[model samples]
Target: MNICWWITILLLLHSCTPGDGMDHGIVGGHVSVPHSRPYMVYIRDSIQPNLNCDGFLVREDFVMTAAHCKNLRNPKVYLGVSDTTFLPLGIEVDSFPHPDFNNEPGNDIMLLKLKTPATLNKTVTIIDLPNLWNDKISKNCLVMGWGSTKYEDYSPSKVLRESNVTLKDLTNCIEPDVICNEDPFGPSQGDSGGPLICGDIAQGIVSFRKTQSKGNVTGYTRISQNLLWINVVMKQHKP
Candidate 1:
C-alpha cells in the first residue's frame, strides 16, 4: 500500500471517533540527557495538579505553549528541569492565549508571561524563532517533553523524553497554520504545548493529534504563521 493510503486510513479512523482530539505525549521516544533541551518548560496548574503541558521559553519573560493549555487555574512553570522529582520551585505565570483561540486547531498557540524574568543559564535558555516564514518544511525535527512515553500509560514521564519526526507535506496538513508529521514514534498524550525544533529554531508548537489502530499523526501550530502576533504580545506585555 502507498503512504498516502495509510494516512487516509488513519485520518478516517480518527474522524470516526466522537468528541475533540486528546492531548499527546512522547510515545516511542527515549529519555533525553539532563537539561539538554534548555528551552523546555514543564507547566502545571497548582490548584489542579493533574492538568499539565509542555512549553518552551522564547524570551526572558515569555514561554510559548498551546492555547488549549490555558484552562489551568494557577499555572506554574518549572524551568531547567530534566526530572520531575528534582524540580526547583515553579515560577508563577499569566497565560496569554491567542486572541482568536477558541479551543480549536488553527489558533492553538499561546504565550505564558513569567511573573519575573527567567534567569538565563547553561541549563535554562531561550530558543530563537524562525527568522522568516518559509513554505518549505524541513525534513527532520526534534520534539521533547515530560509527557507519557506510551499510549496505554497516561502517567507522564518523570524524566524528559525526545523524539525525531519528519515533517509531512503541507498538502497533508489539516490547516494552513499547522505543520503535520506522522511517524511510528511520535507525540501521543500529555505532550501538548511543546516545541517542534527544526534546525535549532522553534518552528512549531505541539497542538493536536489524530490517532487510529494503525498509527497517529501529530500537528504543531506553525510559529512562522503567527510571528506577528507573538511579537506584538511579547512587546506589549514586557516586564
Candidate 2:
C-alpha cells in the first residue's frame, strides 16, 4: 500500500483521540516578547466561552486558521494581544470553513472575514503566505500561542508563548498536504489553527496531533498547497 493510504488509515483509527480540544499548553516553551508577532490572533467561541483557538492575520480583513476551529456562532477575534488579562474588544467576523473540510483530517483550513478592516499598525499586521510549494523547508521553525507552558497545567497562559521546533522530513509525513513535526515541546490544546512559521513565511496551519502516539507528532495543513483556494475564497468574499 502507498504511504498516503497508510497514513489515512492511521489517522482514521486515531481520529477519536484528537488533541485539539484538550486544555493543553505549549510544553517547554517560553513567554514571547510583547507584540513580537503582530499577526497573531486569539479566537474565542462566543457561544462557548472556554472554547478558544489561535489564528493569524493574513490580510486586513481576513484571518487564517484551521477548519476544525469553526463554531456555530461567529467567534470573538482579538488582535495584538500579548497578555490575555488585558485585551481590546474583539472584532466581529464571519466564519468560513473550507467546503471540503467535512470534519476530516485533510482540508483542515479556514478563513475568517472581519466585519471591519483591521487598522494596520505596529502591534497588528499580516503574515505573508507561501508563494510557492517549496519542499525544502527550513529546519528551524516557530509556533506560538497563548497556552500553558507545561503539560501538567490545564489553564491557558495569560501571556503569549512561543516554542522553537525543528521540522521533520516530509518523507515521513502522513500526507503530501501536511508538514509534520515531532517536537517534544510543541503545540497542544488551544494551539490549533496557529501558524507554522518557517523562514518568516506562514508555511503551515496547525491541524491536529496524535494523542495516543509516543512522539506527539503534529500535522499542519500546508499553506502552499491551498493557495488557490485561499485566494479564491478571499476574492469571492471581499466587500
Candidate 3:
C-alpha cells in the first residue's frame, strides 16, 4: 500500500488574511502543554508508529478524526501527551468514517469507539459539540495539535501548538460542506481531524489546506451540519 497520511488536498488555492476579522498569529506556535487542550489526541497506526495523525476526544468512549486517513493499520488512540515518551493514557479502538464520507475534501470526518472509555481527569476531557456550546465561545476560536510548523517540515511538532482563527463566508470554500476561515495560519501536516474550538465548543473538524498557490485559507468539516448523522452513528455504535 502507499505510504500517506489522511489529510486531503485543496483544489482551490487562495490567500487568507485576518484583517477586520480573522485568525492571525505565528505560522505555528507551541502551546503551553499537550494537555492544555485535553481533548487533543494522536492517532497512531501501531503497525507503523512513525506514521500517525491528529484526533480529539468527543465522548468518554469516542474520538473524532479525519475520514480521509489512509493506511491506518492497527489504529490506537494516545490521549494528551506532548512527548510520546511519557505514555499518558490511551485505548485500542475501531474507527468508523462517516458513511457518506467518500474521501472528499469536505466530508472528511470520522469517529472511533474506544475499547475502554477514556479515564477523564485533569488532563483528559471531551470537547463540547457545536450543538451543545454555550455563550462563552467567541467568533474567534483556537485550533491546536502536534502538527508541523511549516510546509517543508514533515515531522510532527514535539509539543502541541495552536492559532486563533475567525470564521469566513462559506461561499469562499470549495466544498459546500466545509467551513472556510480567513486566517493567516492554518493546520499543517499531521493536523488533520484536530478541533476548531470556539470557547468550549468544537465547531469544526480539520479537513485540508491548499498547496501554497494563494493565501492561507484553511478548511474544516462543519460539525453542525452532521449532527443528525453523528447522533445516528453514536446511537448504533456507542458501547
Model 1: per-residue Cα lDDT over 1-239, one tens digit each: 24453343211111111222223336776778888999999897887666778899999999999887877768899999888778788999988999997655678899999998899999999998986676455778898887765655454677888998887675567677887777787665667889998888899998777675756777789999998899899889977
- lDDT by residue for model 2 over 20-84, one digit each (tens)? 32233366678788999999999876666567788999999999988888752558899999887
What TM-score would every model get versus the actual structure? 0.87, 0.86, 0.82
Task: Point out where model 2 deviates above 4 Å.
Answer: 1-25, 212-214
Who wins the TM-score comparison? 1
| Candidate 3 backbone overlaps, count | 5
As for candidate 3, its clashing pairs are 6-69, 14-215, 15-215, 16-216, 23-165
Off by over 4 Å in 3: 1-26, 132-138
**Per-candidate clashes, comma-separated:** 5, 0, 5
lDDT of 2 at 58: 96
Return model 3's CA RMSD, one decimal.
Answer: 7.6
Q: Give the whole-model CA lDDT for all candidates, comma-separated.
A: 0.77, 0.76, 0.69
lDDT digits (tens) for residues 1-239 of candidate 3: 11132243542111121112122212565464546778888787776665667888898999988776644767889986756556655579887888777665667788888998888898888887877422233677788766666654454556677887777565577666678775667687667788888767888888777554467667888787777778888898756
Superposed Cα deviation of residue 67, candidate 2 (Å):
0.3
TM-score of 1: 0.87
Q: How high is the lDDT of residue 116 in model 2? A: 88
